[model samples]
Target chain A: MSGPYGTMAEKVLMKGNEAIAEAAILAGCRHYFGYPITPQTEVAAYMAKRMPKIGGTFLQAESEIAAINMVMGVASTGRRTMTSSSSPGISLKAEGLSYLAGCDLPALVVNVERGGPGLGGIQPSQSDYFQATRGAAHGDFRMIVLAPASVQEMADLTMHGFDLADKYRMTSMILADGTMGQMMEPVSLEAPEVKTYDKSWAVTGTDCKRPHNIVNSLYLVPEDLERTNFERYERYRTIEENEVMYEEFMMEDAEICIAAFGVAARVSKNAIMAARAEGIKVGMIRPITLWPFPKAAFKKAAEHVNTFVSVELSMGQMIEDVRLATECARPVVLCNRAGGMIPSPEEVLQRIKEVNGGMTK
Target chain B: MTTQILIAGFGGQGVLFSGKFLAYKAMMEEREVSWLPSYGPEMRGGTANCSVIVSDAPVGSPIVTKPDVLIAMNLPSLDKYENAVAPGGIIIVDSTLIARKVERTDVAVYYIPATQMASDEGITTLANMIILGKLIRVCDAVSNDNLEAALKKVVSARRADMLDLNKKAIELGFNYAD
Candidate 1:
């Protein structure tokens, strides 16, 4: 991080949205199709300017649905492709996303979420937790979801997200919020190493040299459909077992644990350190990947503490995952702010104090 | 040392740019830094603000609920953030625009007539840079030389013509801060 932020990974100041776009370029994502939306519009704007320079396609699709369908088209040819949108826009693309997942196509979908159920507000919100983590469309499938806390992680996770998608031949998402999307920080980006996947399965022109690769979700036979689903599920299990990513902060012998992710986790760290200053045995468990929730981290917390707090921007959406992860053995409490309001560190500290008082009593 | 600063003003007044300048200066010195803006609806022709953190250690949260330095470029900004400055922190105000006095006695307050000075230089847009001059001079967050170097990097080639005036503005505030 020191020395000149130049050459061999020169550091540059970039916002989270623009960083994601830059990382996409570095990760060999040459095709970009997205509609502009508040908070996340910078990603598309960045792509529009840079994509053409690098011999890439940067199409501003007519709509979110068109954008994702374009993603499907580009991904079919086996080149790295991506689309980005906000909450409401993401909802529209859900159908296209399902089609991509169903066809076993690898592509990147970025959701820099805003307040919503309707058009709610343009401020930051994690209300889309259920939409992003659980299946967004009709059917049973999960995309590889990476939650980035900082602008740096916004870039880092994007690079890794594309890799994971191609490795598993499944769609991957960079689930970010309005806060991280707009914030600026210094980030170092490196070109992705040559990691080629055997894309013999792509619907590229066979030229009659080999059998045609048919990419479709339709397996007319019920048995074949069920087998395809089970096979996908098998891959999901491997992802759950191996692709789980999380971070621990001051959890050793912590009397109280706060489980959160993304911006909430960033805010929680401020409170955790403040609580430690007051001699409160508080720690944090930050889930880096939301889908494969780090159940083991919660289990680790369960071994040390009986009280767990879920800090989030939504009304206890992620708290359910914490409860299930910890098996309801511990009292899982919630500290949240809905409708784009962010909780101050003092407020989080008050919650920690309340939980600590109950423990002492 | 850790300097948590909040710079606030109108959206077109270079509020975020001022914060970015401070952040880049810190980055040049190899100090840990973060710059987070108040985005969304609030950024459109309304009050815009950004939080900047420069620390010897890695930054914990880019969001600053209570900043050690509050730089107010307008009266509305002063009204919104005057009391939020931590006790014993510094409050730098643009005296030409904001007429209200900060009533807090625990914090150090400096009133720099940045707008008047920039207008005197015939470039009203550089008011933010003028106030920025007083900030680094007072806080020593970054050396004047490094701040000047960072200024060179931040002002893009499109507006390369304004660099000298910006330097003059910085020197004016630097002399006026103490």
Candidate 2:
């Protein structure tokens, strides 16, 4: 609630997916192209009704592939544009996300993930952690991946996601789950101003006022392509240095730390609260940006809590990130639930106690 | 203190709407409230249910594992969620559809023939409202003025004709609660 985010209005209950759409609208996003997918169709549905009223383009593209292309087309005109989907649908748009990152264009992508490896049930799952954070598409590119823990974050992240995409001239993704998508909570939202950007790279139909800009993603010369790749990686480094967002809860004097993001983080919060109530000295570090992975928070937490639990919906994807972040300095554990099942707070609390017992031995 | 409630019935029986009304009521009172519905295949003309949590502090988890109050419109919902009620929890059952009684002796049970009450009043769909009225008497999570304001926001203008009937049903249930 504090920071230079923006002026938020009074509180009102909004669904996470609907709030995402509303935030996109507030951020002056006039174009949205997405395919219908469970747990995330609400994004398209809300856009379908709201966009027309605001004179925005809300098209249900033929497919996820087509939707991302439509986003590319819209983004090239110096306007905010977005596309949303679940895990499978995001995979379909992986190539386009690569293209978006390649062209140095700004775009927002929302993935309200459902269970998956292949058409997993339409239940909340964070199985796409590796997919979203480790490069959703085939390329050496990075996206500003934001993981929202609540419906309020679902709305607020869309505002910041667009700004970060435009600020860095790259793609930003709101990595949410079906739980955050379907859950309802009080949110205070503010409408963004009619924004203008330095679109020197945009191929605007400028009436010969300036030279026409060509927007394409083809690099034949290997030397030229390598230069562009290195340039993009430099920008990624800046994002990693400056834009890594994370949250630390009750870390001081704590012996056990829970590292999670999004819905899993919400589950962990409840478990941490219960553990603290029972005198367990447990804490949590929630990664707001999945790309940067908040290694600094882990470093700070490792000074006290030598044991960490990577709570996730997958068997173990983020656990790898935690291990690499801590550099194996601390013993890392996993408490996971796959195939659309959510890990309850009690289950996570039990894991904390078990890990604590192991530490004593 | 936090009040966790579960409202369940067939999909067409206004199960979700009743939960939403309570959630909206809590929100109007500036209380931290969360409403979570059982989504996906479980809610397509089949059994539908929702969890509503109202608290003074921030709600930690939206999923209600054990409910402080259970509003069951039919037999199956009662059978399914009966065991999930906490000790001393209140079970409000629609006697019109559920013939079985609450088996737990630790909890208080209030049986209301909501459907029959609505049908007798010539507004059979007001059963949810009737049960809500009884809940207001038992829980007192929100005041009547707040509940009415929330109902007005929920009811569309085209359904204006049914508002009076719903009000009557709510009042009747409120007075009939024993």
Candidate 3:
């Protein structure tokens, strides 16, 4: 597909995590602090190999907590910075993520997820679905989660995550999986056009002519913190209005609507095709942006579709959102395979056939 | 339309390189494509697989569970994924390592002596490339011209001196019959 700029014929082979790292560097990210983890180690490794070449900063942090705090430290100075990890590592960074959100700092966090509740399998898994979408940390904050199903999206979304973080003054996550992190794809190395940010609010060193700016999350006064919370909530509201993205397929006259995202979407696509071939009216709803949840799109389809099947690699985590989105307008059934296992298209097709025979809800 | 494929084998079998070449060909043809390798602990001793999806439309997901085609370079890969190929799909096997034959009759299976062919062609590393050549010829998943262009782009940038050997291996596999 042609990038937003123009049609460039150049192509290079890159892994998904490596592509995200390259995209971040091209997007003006000057500092990156990360701890190594399975599936996502390539992002840190790529940064380690290339950061010095471009005079950028790369640090192998002691832990994910330290890494995320380091990102906040660099970002508070108005310098673009990022950190990345896998599912369990992200759980460790949750405390720092909450602080970043409370402080309203703009930074990027890439989660190349693996199966998990604890130290789950090292294979690709969407078990972190609730952790990413519902805020695994404490507080009233919400994160902007961008789910990329391909290597190109992995690169593009990394750049977009940084931009959105800056625009909304919050943390944004590229919620990818091991499948995406480890995959190699052809990517164009063309750099995106750089845009400067307004650093007037940044706490750069006191060498500036203006008064010193303080970046902090500590608000001793409850009312002041409440105002800050309300402001952040308003920004999130704006994001919900303008940034929700989803892909629809054959939903116009479908009786069964399958909802999935990321790797599940690929399997569901094949299942939908197979089901259609068997004369079943099955379609798919894939949410590209997992944070906003694409409620309107699901609600619109639920009006006509009799069965909404939520297909995922997790045990019914995203199914909650599907149910909420459909508003109980239709029966939402869950078909999932967790712990590093991906659901096959035939399994999904079987579910569609069963649902077609009044075996639902 | 798009074709999603998974090519898998041992670490030193050039499985990843074969997948990369196919993805490169798709990109050169101006198609939307993605190639993903098996990450995490699987890179240790277990089988290694790379998923390559080449499509005319914007590819929504890069992971391939039910691939339209599969290229199995080892016995384990064939055992694991032989049944996953779609009906009327294509399965290209390296008979050099895989002793047992596939049981599925719904898909077309071609058992090529890729390792022996590459050895006969005087280059052992070209086995995967040879299999890729067969894939392009039988499935037409990618055109010969696009494959050659992609091979030039990848090999010239890294192994310029070995271009002749790689081309010869590709031709041997492309021309292999039955």
The best candidate in terms of TM-score: 1
Which sequence of candidate numbers ranks them by DockQ, best first? Answer: 1, 2, 3
Tell me which residue pairs clash in candidate 2: none
Total clashing pairs for each candidate: 1, 0, 4
Of the pair 2 and 3, which is ahead by TM-score?
2
Interface RMSD of each: 1.6, 2.9, 2.8
**Docking model 3 quality class:** medium
DockQ of each: 0.70, 0.54, 0.52
lDDT of 1 by residue, B1-178 (tens): 8789999988998989888888888888888788989985765469999999998877777888788999998888889898899999999999898988999999999988889988988888889988988898889677788455777778898988777877887788888834
With a 3 Å backbone cut-off (N, CA, C), the pairs that clash in candidate 3 are: A183-B36, A183-B37, A184-B35, A184-B36
Q: Each prediction's Cα lDDT score?
A: 0.89, 0.87, 0.86
TM-score of each: 0.97, 0.96, 0.90
Better of 1 and 3 by DockQ: 1
Residues A207-279, candidate 3, lDDT per residue (tens digit)?
7767898888889999999999999889899999999988898898999999988778877887888788889
Ten-residue region with minimum lDDT total, candidate 3 chain B: B37-46
CA lDDT for candidate 2: 0.87
True contacts kept of 1: 0.72
Descending-lDDT candidate ranking:
1, 2, 3
